[model samples]
Target: MTAAPVEGELAMVGEVAEQLRDVRRHVDFFDNDVHQARDLAREADSRSLATETTVAGFARWLERLEQSNEALRRETATLRGHHPPDPQRPPRHRCSRYAPPIHLSALGEEAGDTA
Candidate 1:
């Protein structure tokens, strides 16, 4: 009878040990997940910072481009004030497109009148 009770107690203790091992495995899995999440968060933060830095650089470049364009416009206005357009010359369009000046005198007199 004493041996039977001792065997039963050992079996119970074995079951408890197995349960503890299962709990430890679950804890380890969740711990690994937490670490992975932290790593991903850090990576996202790094990318966000890089993107912000690039945008800031672009903003600075755009500001400089606008300033240069404004300066060129002011200089062109000043030049146009100093030199009046000849009545015989064709009027220029307000555009960035460049057209080579056509010498009407080089062409026949009739070709110049075709304009």
Candidate 2:
């Protein structure tokens, strides 16, 4: 006979699904806003005036969205403890090639050493 799901387990699953849905909705909203901001920034760029304010506003919006996304991810991880791909650890593979340039002078090291 198949075992039935416990009340707490079912409740947790429902909560997780709801949270996942919320995360998706927020992501969609954030994406739409970002697209709109990009369009506005492009328009401002075409004009004589600087688009700094518009771009800054878009950056702020993106920051908030990123924060919310991170929080939701943490919450989901907590709900599903001991799952694969532990959030605390970094991935093994080198995902990207965009490393920030190191300033040797700032670090009190010779620039030649960095080569």
Candidate 3:
């Protein structure tokens, strides 16, 4: 009876040791996971900061462009006020440079009449 109890106690001790080793392995795996998560979070933070800075730079550039556009508009209005266009003359077309001036005799030929 005494020998049987001692054998059972030794078997329980071996099982407990195995379980403790498994627990240690799980703890190590969990620690590695935490470290990787922290690294990922840090990388995300850096990328977000870079994006924000780039957006801010673009915003400033856009503001400057708007101001320049407004100034050019004001200048154009001032110039137009100084030298108003001749209302009696038609606005010139870009295609006018590519073709000869149309005459009244050409219109008559297209209509089958010499007017």
Candidate 4:
């Protein structure tokens, strides 16, 4: 009710208001820091997921390449065995003709004549 007491009450209220403002600024700073930390954590997790995906893709690609190489080796072997040499020419025949040569008893017989 008195003027001095009223002035004293107003000053006290002003100090309380200033302290509240400082507390609010500190809370805002802390909230921003928490949000930034969460964002960084999410980014790290996303990077880890991408790296795992890349590694898995590389593993699959390597497996396919190995399968392709094995298939090529099998095809090469099959191609090598597919052709048969001319049996009429004994010198040009393949090594599959490995039997022992039976020399002709008659002197008039030819080299490549099987008859």
Candidate 5:
């Protein structure tokens, strides 16, 4: 039978995922600004009747921010799919203090990068 990923390996993947997710999250960290930009664009339509350049510029920026956020979400989902968490395992998430078990046998080799 194949061996499962060791707890430490899973923890490392989890840590990496968390860090990467955090970085991706920062791509659109200004959520408030996105919403405000959208609101301003809508209001500008009423105030300027689609004549103001600033409104269109803000609209484009907001759209790009939204797209980036969607892409990041997709990436996070893909990452989770590859490294699902096992709550039963220790070294939960970023808690990497738990030492990795010794795995020198064939099964350990079979575990691949997962440990």
Candidate 6:
């Protein structure tokens, strides 16, 4: 009958419409997820850049500190070399004044004593 055929055609059209709606919904959800992922990636990249900059700054600071320390060490060595302790002052000998001096010649008679 013509009525039966028309009903079957209408049913097919309804099923196709439902499928199309489902597909559109899935596409919208996927688009939203992709946008959120991109935003998160951008945020992570920004944080990494900030951290890298901070680390670089710290490295430069450490280098400067090392240079300053080296300069201080050189200054100290220069001062020590230029201004030696006075040697004309009396020596602080722990032994008694009457003790005989220990000559190097007594250690061995092989070489002549230089002292």
User: What is model 1's C-alpha RMSD?
Assistant: 7.8
lDDT of 5 by residue, 1-115 (tens): 1335577788899999999999878866778678889999999777786566678889999999999997887788688774434458764455463567765675766677765
CA lDDT for candidate 4: 0.85
What local lDDT score does residue 28 receive in model 3, on the 0 to 100 scale? 100
Q: In candidate 3, what are the lDDT values of residues 6-77, reduced to their tens digit?
A: 999999999999999999999999999999999999999999999999999999999999999978877896
Q: Which candidate's TM-score is highest?
A: 1
* lDDT digits (tens) for residues 1-115 of candidate 4: 6999999999999999999999999999999999999999999999999999999999999999999997887788578784443458555455555776666664355644766
User: Between which residue pairs do clashes occur in model 3?
Assistant: none
List where candidate 4 sits over 4 angstroms from the true fold.
80-115
**Superposition error at 65 for model 3 (Å):** 0.8
Return the TM-score for candidate 3, rounded to 2 decimals.
0.63
Compute the lDDT of residue 32 as modeled in candidate 4. 100
Off by over 4 Å in 3: 1-6, 82-115
In candidate 5, residue 96 scores what lDDT? Answer: 66
Which candidate number would show the highest lDDT if scored against the true structure? Answer: 1
Deviating ranges (above 4 Å) for candidate 2: 1-5, 49-115
- Candidate 1 vs candidate 4: the TM-score winner is 1
lDDT-based ranking: 1, 3, 6, 4, 2, 5
Off by over 4 Å in 6: 82-115
Per-model TM-score, in order, reads 0.68, 0.36, 0.63, 0.61, 0.28, 0.61
lDDT (C-alpha, whole model) for all candidates: 0.88, 0.80, 0.87, 0.85, 0.76, 0.85
Give the number of colliding residue pairs in candidate 1: 0
Compared with the true structure, model 6 gives a TM-score of 0.61
